[model samples]
Target: MVRIAHIADTHLGFRQYNLDEREHDLYNIIDEIAEKILEERVDIVIHSGDLFDSPRPPAQAYYAFKRFLAKISGRVKFFSVLGDHDTPKRRGMPPQKLFDDEIRVLGLTGGDHQVLRLNGRDVLVAGVSHFSRRYREILVEELKKLDVIAASHQVSVIALHQAVDRFFPFEEVFELRLDDLPRNFKYYAMGHLHARTRASFGKGELAYSGSTEIMRSDEISDWEKHGKGFYVVDLSGDKLDVREVNLEGVRPQLEVRIKYDAFDLELKKLVEFLKTYSGRKSPIAHIIVEGKEVDRQRVQQSLNKALLGKVLYFRSRIIEEPEKEFIELKPGDINISALLKEYLRDEKVAEFGYELFKVLKEGDVEEAKKIADEYFRRMMKIDSEKGVS
Candidate 1:
């Protein structure tokens, strides 16, 4: 029997553009989650990928990761497969050993996948780390090679980082199809998609243990408020039981909507909203104000007081010119007058449309009414061949 903890996508050094103090706040939250793992006394910790937001994280991020490792050293064995973010050559060779050898971390790049004997049974741990985006599909090929070795009743688990088959729009990068994976493995532990999902494909259990921190807005809507956590896998012979371990002290996300014709009135209303809703320990706030010519600075400045004494992240956008031209249509710019021409001509608009739709929270409000109506109309017409109302 082997007890393993699976977590991924810490995304260290991620910049929090909206809030002044949000970056450090997220880092601290991750530390808390790691500490919880130590307290649980899991035998091994497996990070699927994306340890750093960049291939090279800033000094602060390095120190934070080091501190986290210090807390769990000797207590739990940590093994991780590098994601696209962990650049192997950028950091030089010696310090890389600090992650692999001294840290008791074992995975691809440091060592090839191997079979371990536990309780008189064999279990194979096969892994491949952060291949460059262009060549990440090598993972599928590597798995095929492993399938040549036949092991009867042995549980083979693959820790993979890349996206697969557009699990979500955001997860389309390392995109793979169900056919890409080998047919022999018993378990497939995956990352990069920030959702807890389970599926049976090719005689194996495919599971994704999402991120330990919530940094993206869409993660909230898609994950059903279940983004922050790790998974505990209890392995006994040929069967596996998985459970979620919630990290404590995470602030709940607050989506506040205040509408006014005047920007001044909107600012005043925002302050009042913050004052009434703010909490000391866990303050995750997303503020959206809709009006014409909204003074972004005034609203941000006024809410400063309300934001103090709490951990809050605020996002604001001004939609003053509602029907304003999104793009200029020129005679030379393809015939946008036609529906297909309009949709396919501007790929940028389509991408922007997806991004905007992800952030607009409320569906039953006047602010998002037009935006939602346009999105549904276009989507239905294109994908379903239904006319816009």
Candidate 2:
């Protein structure tokens, strides 16, 4: 049996507020991941990408990484590719070669491929990193020249850090398709998408390990909870099995939509649902109340007080019902906030810049940097705060 661990998007050193505390928590998560691998006794570990939240990780981040790598030395083989966030935007940024041989980093150059031998079977891994804004072929053409099928009789897996498919809005940013892959690999382990999923395309299995941590309120809201972790893959000869090892407990997620007339009754129902499900094993909770008649602040206050700190986030929207059908190109056709979102979605550059502007306008320099990072993240399609294709 060839046991392998697949993890992605660790996003170490992701400090939003309370730098010391957040940084500590971030490293703790990394420790948790490494611990899982050591306990399982996996033969090799593959980190799809996004090891660091920032391209130029803080000294603390590097120190933590080095320490963790030292702990796992000689016990398990580890491999990582450059994620969009891990690679600095400026040209001539240093490569992972600067790190000691104990840490093996792959895909620093535009086109790079790696092959590992596990129990005498060759596991071929190929990848492409975000070098710029323009979306180009994911180097599948170059990968085919390697002839993966002939290299191994035990089993073979391809590691890539690109979007799942082309239907996503940011597909134009990192466009990749299932058909573009080499036909003979047994599994295509992918990253850059923060959802746990498996798809059978061509002749292999395509899988995303998802983000190991929740980076945004939108992600928590969309996924509806927080129990982030990695995928453990077990390979026996030519067969493969995979499972998710969740570090955090399961948190309940609730979304309620009520009409203006039914506010009183629905509000009670929503609260009842929140209270009943909020007592789960998970430490985090997310509740979203959206409708035409929602009282955003009041709902937030009620929910916040009721759940206290257990509620990771609460979002409520107020939208008035339309009296008649909306006329095209007419005023008051769409809700104010809805209209703003629609307008912002079209202009990519301005939309990103404004996200940065929002933090600056609020006079939070550190926060402004975080949001600015997100802007570049959005443009790169690396942030799945929106959704997967």
Models 1 onward score TM values of 0.70, 0.70
| Tens digit of per-residue lDDT, candidate 2, span 86-168 | 77655655344456486566656644656677676666655555433233443655555534542553366666677645423
Model 1: lowest-lDDT 10 consecutive positions: 358-367
Runs in model 1 deviating more than 4 A are 18-21, 88-96, 103-111, 150-153, 169-174, 222-224, 261-279, 282-284, 291-313, 321-389
Clashing pairs in 2: 292-319
Clashes per candidate (backbone, < 3 Å): 2, 1
lDDT of candidate 1 over 1-389, digit per residue (tens): 77678888877777655453566766787788677787776766777887776555677877888888888877776767776555553444422345664343334452246666755667677666655444545656676776654234466667777677636433323456667766776767787777777777555577788876666665666445565688888766456778888766544566666674654566566556556644454456676666677777877776665556553556655455573365345434542224343665776456545434433431213324545667667776786655434
Candidate 2, overall lDDT? 0.62
On the 0 to 100 scale, the lDDT of residue 242 in model 1 is 80
